[model samples]
Each structure stands twice: as structure tokens, then as C-alpha cells.
Target: MQHNLGVIGLGHWFGWLEKGVGEKGSLKLVKAVGTKPFEDKAKLLTGFGITKDRYYISDPDGKIPEEFFEGLDLVHISDPNKFHKAQAIESLEYGKRVIVEKTLAINEREFEEMKSFLKKKGMEDRIYLHLHYLHKQPTLALAREMPGLVAKYGKITSIEANFFEPVNEEDPRRTWLLAPENGGIFMDWVHTSEIIFRMTKCSFGGIKKASDFGVNTDYDSVNPTGVETVVEVSGSSYENGALATMRMAKGTEKALANKTLRIVFKSGFSVFACFPGHEAEFNNAGARGTLKILDAKGKEISSESLSGQNSSEIFISEILDFCDGKRVGLNLDEITEIFKSQWEYQRTAGTRRLITDRESIDAFLRNGASYTYCK
Candidate 1:
């Protein structure tokens, strides 16, 4: 059965989601609501059966129209961070299954409201949080093999994950992110904490904001003060003694392309997983990720490229299963744990200094920096 999909915000990711709907996929894109008309982009989407009439401009208030949800079986919320809770609740109120982007909500109050509203509607299983990283390989493969790896090695002692993106001078998304009300970089990159929680089953004890490197002056002339572009966070596992560190950056010319997760064990061995390039993954190609087992001395003992579906396909598959009435994706309990961890981090760290000078930007990018693919 083809499940109709209505998109609340046609931002950068919806294009990739469109690709995930392969010729015979179960989902279909019928109606969409964006802040603007998106003229040039509409030409491309018409091939997928979406016409000009299908694209509706959002109201200034950000409430989606009832007519838009009338015939939809599911709704995808890709709006700005602040709008997630309202749009998600509206979708549920209309009896539409929902797939939302990360950070569930900006704060605990909003999250609880969403939780309460969904439960009231009795559509808890109809919602899913699209944490694409969880579906990516070496993520899935490593998570599946964690127990065996722990048995062979010892218990995990620490985990380090890093995600960095080269600055795009022309990308308007960077400008949109500068508004403090938009949730800034912390809400965007909190998924790193989720990755840690999923693997260790430990909530973050406390998150310390190590540094915040905002956009460079020359790159973003509009906001000279800039918003957070790069940040380093360290936290210990709540239950287990394991430690986790994450560094996330965006909109910096000095930044390099890096996405990886490294898990170290007590027995003097570690496993490092490297994800595929973003373009390949978004293209719906069978992007392959690699996992390398290294000895304590950093000697590579074994390595293999694990092949699997990209995040887009994996997310679509899960949502389709959900539409079929099978329980999948994160449950309310899992969502609560992840949301609480993220909220604690945001409350404790807040926002740090805005790095405007070249010296500090270089310093923040020094450790855990990668140059494999520069932009």
C-alpha cells in the first residue's frame, strides 16, 4: 500500500528523503508546505507527481492547514528546531503518522507536551524520530556486535565521536542558524550524545562545554558576533564508569570533513568506525562504512568495509514498517532518555564565547581534526 506523505518544511533534507522513495517504495510524496514557493526546486519535484498546487506556503504563525493534512497518511517535520513540537502535535491531531528530525524538542517542557499529546491521541507507535546516524553502517554493525566485542575485549571505557563540516559561504542555512531562538548549534548536534547513550545504555552524567567557535568574521559578515559554529563537549556515563567526548563544528573554512565514532575498551583494544562521505550517503547509493580493530599501541589488527543501505533508505524502511503497524524506531521511553540527556547538556552548557579570530578557530580545530576530504 502506498502511504501518502505530507512534508511540513521542504528544507535541505527533504530532497534526500525523496530519493529514498525508490520506484517501488511504500511511501509517496503528495502535498508539501514550505515557508516560501521554492520555484526552482519545484521543477525537480514535479517529476515525483507534486504539482504547483501541491506546494502551499506556510502561514506566518507556522500552523499547517487542516486541508494539507486531510488526505495524508504521514507527515514529515523538517521545519526549524523551534517549530518541531507544534507541527508534530498538529500532525498527530489530524491522525497522520509523523517522522521528525532530531532533538525531539528544544526543551523538556515542549517534549513533555508532545509526549502527553501523542499519548492522549493513542498514536504513540505512529511517530518516529529520524536519527539518520543510527541507521548508518558501522553504526548498525558496531552496535549489533558490541556485546561480542565487549566479551572479547573488556568493557567499554570511553567513546569519542566527531562531526565537522567545511564552511559554505553561500549557504543560507548557516545564517538562519544564527538566531538564538532557532536553538543554535547545540540542539542540532545533540545526536552525538544519543549515539553515546544508545551504545552504553548510560545517560550523560553532566555535560561540560569545552569551547565554542562561532563563525569567522569574514565568512559571516552579517553577524560579526556570530553564533556557535564549533563546540567540544565532555561527559561521563551516568551509570557505567565510561566516558564520552564529542566535537561538532560547521560553517568554518578551516574545518575538514570528519564523521567517526571510536570506542575504547579496558582490555587495551579499540574499534573505530568511519562513515561514508555525505554526498554518497545522500544520493541513496549503497555507501559502505569501515570498522577497524586496533591494538592498544594503535596497530591495526583487522579492518573491513561494511556495506548497507544509507540512512535515507533505512529511515524510510523503518517508517514504512511503522505505517504497517509494527512497533519500530525509538519508543517513548527511549525518546525520554535521549531528550533528557540533551536537555541537561543544553541547560548546563548554554552558549559559550563566539570565536571571531583566526587564531582561536585554528586552535579549536587543531585536536581531532581530519583532512581526508577538504572543502
Candidate 2:
């Protein structure tokens, strides 16, 4: 009953190690492919049940060796966004299930190609996106309440969601994240967009007033080497006729750190969710801060404190369910629509200078931006 797994990237080894690795767990890592040397990754791979002989360096041409997929029941592709389409389609050709990281492709064309291939093979359920944020406690709680809230208070009317993480100069992700081929800050919003979709079950309508900082002052330079250190976008949703605004940024200071979602209903009822890292202080344990129901007068109706949980632990459990043909994650059509919205924003969004100085920072704060929990 063991499901053999092969990994296409090593950036997440530390997190993946926590997933049950051997006979005690359902997933067994049979092969590992990465850009790093075998010696550097062998110890970590061994911990994940990958034998030394099974570790292979990816080809310089970026082609996955055909033999690597010979025995894998599924492949976990955590490579950069630009590499997802080729790797995913290739894995599917070998009849292995695929779990890819978010921002599934760098552009709409690539996203659609993956979808078309899946349909042609009739393996639509064989691929899943590793949008781990969806597994966070507050998100799960909000998802549970969405149905009842809509039935009682009517459809959602407005939404404001943002995720800001401090940029670590030494962080390895910064390199590729800034690469033009990977689709810049616009691609990073896939997580935020998917969250909006899941919570409201609405398709993104189109981009309106989208902008990014840190790339360039030239508004036409939507795809550039200097990816957005900060991005903010507002748009509409199809089904519920809601105005949704989302912001995502990696800032150099703690002043820009937060993760929250606010949903307002037609009846003046709202749900405010403080996700992990809502505070400037980050923690290892993924304790989602709180979920509060607020009235139009801003009085708290009910609040739930979600306990600390490991994200990887939740991901592995849900992904296993996905491997069993369960529809626990976003479907291909939803992914296609999300990417379409991203493309529209990229083509139309204006580029602004990076917000680094005190004057700009103060101006940003004064523009009615608040990250604190419902008070």
C-alpha cells in the first residue's frame, strides 16, 4: 500500500523531512533530483527514505531523466515556477501523479498547456498544487463557516486580504524570485488569489488599479529582473459581485509584515481572520492567530483561537488524500482562471519605484492600511 514518491526540488527538504518517511508512512521517497551536489543533499534525502543511488542531479538542459519516473507513484515538484509546466506534463506522461508548488506556471499559455494535457489523458485529478496556505488553521475554519454565513447573511460584498513577509537578504529564494523568466511579483499573488477563490467560491473578474513597487518606475516594465518587493491589487469577483482587494509584499522591515483576510457581507456581518504571521513576529509553530465574527458596529460576535499546527504535517495528510483521487484542492479550471487574472494584472498594472524611504513608508501606512486583528 506504499505510494512511492520522487522529488524534483530540494529547497523544501527541511519541511518534507517531517512527513512520515518510511514503512510507518504511506509515502516513500524513492528518487531525488536537484541542482545541488549529491553529497550535499544525500544526508537529507536519506532522512526522507531516498537511497544514495537514487539521488540524481537534474540535467543541465532541465530535462528530467526518464528513468527517475520509472517507479514513482507520484512526483513532488517544488522547483521554480518557470519549470513547473514541463516537469508536470512530463511526469504525467509517465503516469505518475504530480504535486506542484503554487503559481503553477509563469504564464497563461503554459498553464493552459498543462490543463489540456491533463484532459487529453483523462488524468485531470492526477495533479495538485501545493498551496499550503490553504491548510492553515484559520483558512480551514473560514472555509467551514462560508456556507452558513452566506445562507444567513447573504453573499459576500467586499474583501481585503494581504500577506506581507519580511525579506531576508540571505534567503535563497530571493535570487530566482527576481528573475524575469519566473514571472515576478504578479506570480506570487497566486496564493492570495487562491485563498480568495476558496473562501468565496468566486472567479476573479479582472484586474483594476494594480501596482507594484521595487521593479522599476517604468509602468511598462511589468516583467523585469527586479521583481516586486511589494504589490497591491484590487478587482471584482464574478459569482457574488464582490469587490476584492489583495496585497502581497516582501519588505525589508518588520513594519510591512502581516497576513490577514477580511470579508464583509451584505447584511453588515463580517469575518476577520488573522493567519499565521499576522504579527511582525514570526514563529516556527504554525498557530493561526484568530478568526472573529464582527457586526456592522464592529462588535465581536464569536472568536476562535486555532491551535498551533505544522503546515507540512497538514500538507502531507491532504496530499495523500489527493493521491487517492479525492477532490480536496482547487480544480484545473479554477487554476486556469486564477492564472488568467494574473496575466491580466501583469499586462495592465503599473510599476512604481521601490518603497524604501521613510516618506513613502509613512504615506503607505496613512492610506487606511491596517493589519491588526479586529478590535
Candidate 3:
């Protein structure tokens, strides 16, 4: 069955989705709604033979024409962070299955609104969050090997993850990313956070304590918003009693680019590294990296370079299953827990607070207080 897709954003990432579908032959690009006329420049449309008639530039008022929504089996929402909830809700209300990009919303209030609407309309099964990183080679390898590693090494005691991207102040591509309103490091780090959640089996136990700090010393002139060019987050997870820390940065020399995940168990440790690029890199034939596991005495237990499998390919395959009724969308409870922990961090940005219970987390989210740096 070929599911017709309506894409809400025409950014570079959309190209990966289009290419993945093209390769699988299980989906079709019927129409696209974006703020600009991206058809001419989008290699996916031209390369895949998607006709020009399928692209529709959104109205100046920012409304997508109602007609464009017709006959779409799936709507892929990859617009800016602020628009995610509304776009996903609208797509679901129109009876279209939706795959929304990560950071489902910029904050908890928006997430709750979308969650409530989905429940009210009984449309939970129709939506999925595009956490494609989970399907990446390194992540999949970790999941497949973690149980044995933990058993052999004892309990996981600490984790360190970092994703750094080089930024050019003159590059138009980063305009939205440099604005806090659109979500700076907070929005971009969702991938890293979800990776952590999965790696730990959602055992973070609600973020016992968290602290965040942001600095915009790099491109403050062009980014009047003073959005953080660098962000640092550290916290303790309740369940495993593990200390977790993450560092994300936007402005850096290309030579210094880095994306790495390291976890230390009671008796051993493992490290995974990949380039700092789109999730599609995991799918590229040339995309390869190393996973190194060491025992307590620093003796290498296993070390291997992984490559060949594409994360986008895996993601597209899973998406096809969802379309064919073989698999349900992302688990709502899992998503809720992730967002809850995210909100806790945002609520206490730059400070540390031990979130004692679910009720306390709920109160913080209900208050709808904006994260100071993000606001």
C-alpha cells in the first residue's frame, strides 16, 4: 500500500524522509506545504520525480490551505518547534496519521494540550514522534548489547553524552536555531535526551535533580535573541542512581565537531562516537563509527567499527509498518515521561531541584512557567 504523504516542512531533513520512502516504494509524496517555494531547490522532489504541482507555499498568514489536507494518509510535521503541537493536532483532527519531529513541543504546556486533544479525539494511534536516532546504528548496537554489558560489568553508574555542531554566523540555515523562542539548544538536545531515555530504558526515574546553563558568547551580534551557543546540563537519575551529563553547542570549528555517548558501569564502560550531522548520516554507506567496551581493568572486551545500515532506512521501514497496521505509533507513556523530565529540567533551569514525586512534576508543568533562558 502506498501511503500519500503531506510534508509540513521542506528543510534538509525532509529530503531524507522523501529519499527513504522512494527507496522503500511504500509511500508517495502527494503534497507539501511550506513557508517558501522550496520545490526548485529541493533535491528530493526533483531527484525522486515528485511533480511541482505537489508543493504549496503556505499563506502569508501562516495557514495551510484546507484543500492541501485532502487525501493525505500521513502528515509529516517538521516545522519549527513553536508550530509542532498545532500542526500535529490539526493533522490528527483532519483524520491524517502524523509523524512529528522531536521535541514534540517547545515545553510542557504545549505537550499537555496536544496530549489532551489526542485523548479527547481517541486519535492516539494516529500519531508518532520521529525519534529516528533510536534506529541509528550506534544506538541500536547499544540496545542490543547493553543487557549483556550491564550483567557483566555490574550496574550503570554514570553517563556522558555530547553533540556539537559548527556554526557559521552568516549561514541562513541557522536563523531559527539561534533564537530562543524557536528553541535553541533546548529544542536541539531532544535527540540526545531521547537517546539517553532509551539507553537507560526510561529508568531515569523522573530526573531527581537537574541544572542547566546557557551562554551565547559566539554569535550574539547576529543572534540578538542571545540564544545559547553553548548549553550544559547535568542531573542525577533516580532509578539507577546514575549521574548523567550532556553538553550541546552550536558554534564551533568544523575540525572540533563531535557526537559521542559514553556510559560507565560499576565495573566497565563503553563509548560510541559518530559525526555531528543529521540522522541520515547513520544511513549513509560511508557513515561508520566505533563502539568500544572496556572491562574494569581497562582491558578491551569488545571493539568494532559499525556501518552500512542506515537509520533513515530503519525509520522508514518502521513507518511503513505503522501505515500497514503492523505496528502502533510511539508509546504515549514513554513520550509523556520524557517530556516530564524535560519540563523538570526547564522548570529548574540553571538550578538543581530534587523532583520527589510525579505530583510535583505535574504541578511544575501545570504552572506553565517559561524557562528563563528559553523565553
Candidate 4:
């Protein structure tokens, strides 16, 4: 069955969805909404064989044309973070399945609003968060082997995950990243948070406390106030008392050798690393990466390297499942929990707060004033 897909944004990231949908052959890109001029839209849509009639220009008021939702089986939202909730809620209401870009909502309130809308319509399973990294070969391998490793070594005691990329002031994509409402590192780094949650199997013990530091600076006069260039977050997990730290930076002197995930158990440790060019390798055949395990004495116990595993396959598989009326991974509740924990982390930035009970977290989430941000 071919699912007719409509895209809400035509930015650079939309290319990934276009490529995947084209390759999968189970989905058709039929329509799109963008804020570009007609000539530009003609040029962009020509490549995809999408007619000008199917290409829509969004209004200044951010209203989607009624016609855009006419025949879409699914709508892929790659728009700005601020617009995600309304666009997604509208799509689901129109009876279209949704595939939203990462950081599903900018904050907990928006996430909760979307959750409430879905539950009211009983369409809770119709949306999927596009967390493609979790589908990578290295991550999958780690998830598969983690149980045995934990059984042998002991419980996880500490974790370190780093996702860093040099800021490109010249890139058009940098505009949204600089805005706090569109979400700086707080929204972007949710992928890492999801990875941590899945790695620990929702066993991070409920996030006991969190502290974050954001470095805002001007780069090439892009914006006078500048965007966050560096973000470092540290927190303690609830269950096993595991301490986790994640560092994400937009500006760095040198690119990182790899995006790394390291887990240290009570007795031994293991590390999984994925380099920048893995995606290209993944497309050609599969991405290559390393998984190394070491004993407490620092003696290497086992080391395995993987090659040629495409993570996009996971996205394709999930799309297929959605079309087939099957439930996909990363349900509403799970993603909401992730958003809640990350919000607490963001709210408590630059300070530490030990949340000893659920009541405090509930009270904080309930207070609308705490959710307000600079517009």
C-alpha cells in the first residue's frame, strides 16, 4: 500500500525524509507547505515532480491551507520547534498520521497539550517521534548486548554521552538553533536523553536532580545576543543511583572524533562510538562503528566493530508498521516522560535541585508561570 505523504516544511532535513520515502517505495510524497516564493517553490518541487498546485505557501499568521490536508495519509512536520504542537495537533485532527522531527515539543506544556489532544481523539498511537539515531546499528547492538553485559559486570553506575558539532554561522539552518523558543540545546539534546532512557530501559531512576550551563555568545555578528554555543548537563538517576553527564556544543575548535556513549558498570565498562561520516557509510551499505568492553582492571574483555548498517531502515520499518495498523516504538507516554524529565533539567539549569518525591515534579509541571519563556 502506498501512503500519500505531505510535508509541512521543506528545509534541508526534509531531504532525509524525501530520500527515505523515495527509497522505501511504500510512501509517496504528494504535497508540501513552505514559506518560499513561487519561483523558488517551482524549482524545489520540480525535482520531486510535485506540481505547483500541490505546493503551498504558509500564511504570515501560520495557518495551513485547508486543501493541504485533503488527501494525505501522513504528514511529516519538519518545521520550527515553536510550531510543532499546533501543526501536529491539526494533522492528527485531520485524521492523518504524523512523523514529527526530534524534540517533539519545545516544552512540557506543549507536549502535555499535544498529549491531551491525542487522548481526547483516541489517536494516541497515530504519531511517531523521528528519533532516527536510536535505530543506528551501533545503538541497536548495544541494546541487544547490554543485558548480558549487565548480568556479567553489574548494574550501570555511570554514563557519559557527548554530541558535539561546530557551529556554522553561514548555514541557513542556524537561525532556529539560536532561538531559545525554537529551543537551543535543551530541545536538540533530547535525542541524547531518549538514548539514555532507552539504554537504561527507563531505569534512570526518575532523574533525581539536574544542572545545566549554557554559553551564549556572538559568532560573526549573526545575532547581537548570540545563540548558545555550549551546553553541559549533569544529573543523578533515580533507580540505581547512576550518575550521567551529557555535553553538546555548537561551536568548537575541532570537530569531535565521534559521538560517543559510554557506560561504566559497577565492575566493568563498555563504550560505543559513532563518527561523523557514519551516515554516508550507512547509506552505501551500513555505518561502521566500534563497541569496546573492558574489565575493571582495564583489560579488554571484548571488542566488536560494525559496518554497513543503515539506520534509516528503522524509520522505513516504522512507517510501514504505522500503515499496517501496528503500534510503533516511542509511544506518547514514553516521549512525554522524556519531555518532562528534560524540562526539569532545563528549568533547573545553572542550579541543582534534589527532587525527592513526585509531588514536587508534579507541582512544578502544574505551575504555568514556570513554563513561560522569552517570546
lDDT of candidates 1 onward, in order:
0.69, 0.66, 0.63, 0.64
List residue ranges in candidate 2 displaced over 4 A: 13-24, 151-154, 169-173, 215-241, 277-286, 307-310, 326-328, 349-358, 365-369
lDDT of 2 by residue, 214-283 (tens): 4222212233312222222233322344577776655434655567788887788788887665221124
Candidate 1 Cα misplacement greater than 4 A, ranges: 38-41, 215-240, 284-286, 349-351, 355-357, 370-375
Residue 74 in model 4: shift from native, Å?
A: 0.6
Best by TM-score: 1
**What does candidate 3's lDDT look like per residue over 1-375, in tens digits?**
788888888776687787687777668877888786664557755665656776777665446778879888988988777778877877877888889888667777778888888788887778888875777777777767777776766666776666655555443444665465555556666666677676556544445444333223444433322112122223322224566665555554554446677777776554444532564374457665567776566566676778766777788888888787665545888787555555665655545323334464333322222211111
- How do the residues 76-108 of candidate 1 rate in per-residue lDDT, one tens digit apiece? 998887888888888887888889987567777
Total clashing residue pairs per candidate? 0, 0, 1, 5
All candidates: CA RMSD (Å): 3.6, 4.6, 8.6, 9.0
Model 3 residue 19 lDDT score? 66
Clashing pairs in 2: none
Ten contiguous residues minimizing lDDT sum, candidate 1 = 224-233
Best by lDDT: 1
After superposing candidate 3 on the true structure, give the runs of residues whose Cα lies further than 4 Å from its correct spot: 38-48, 168-172, 205-240, 271-276, 279-286, 297-301, 350-375
Models ranked on lDDT: 1, 2, 4, 3
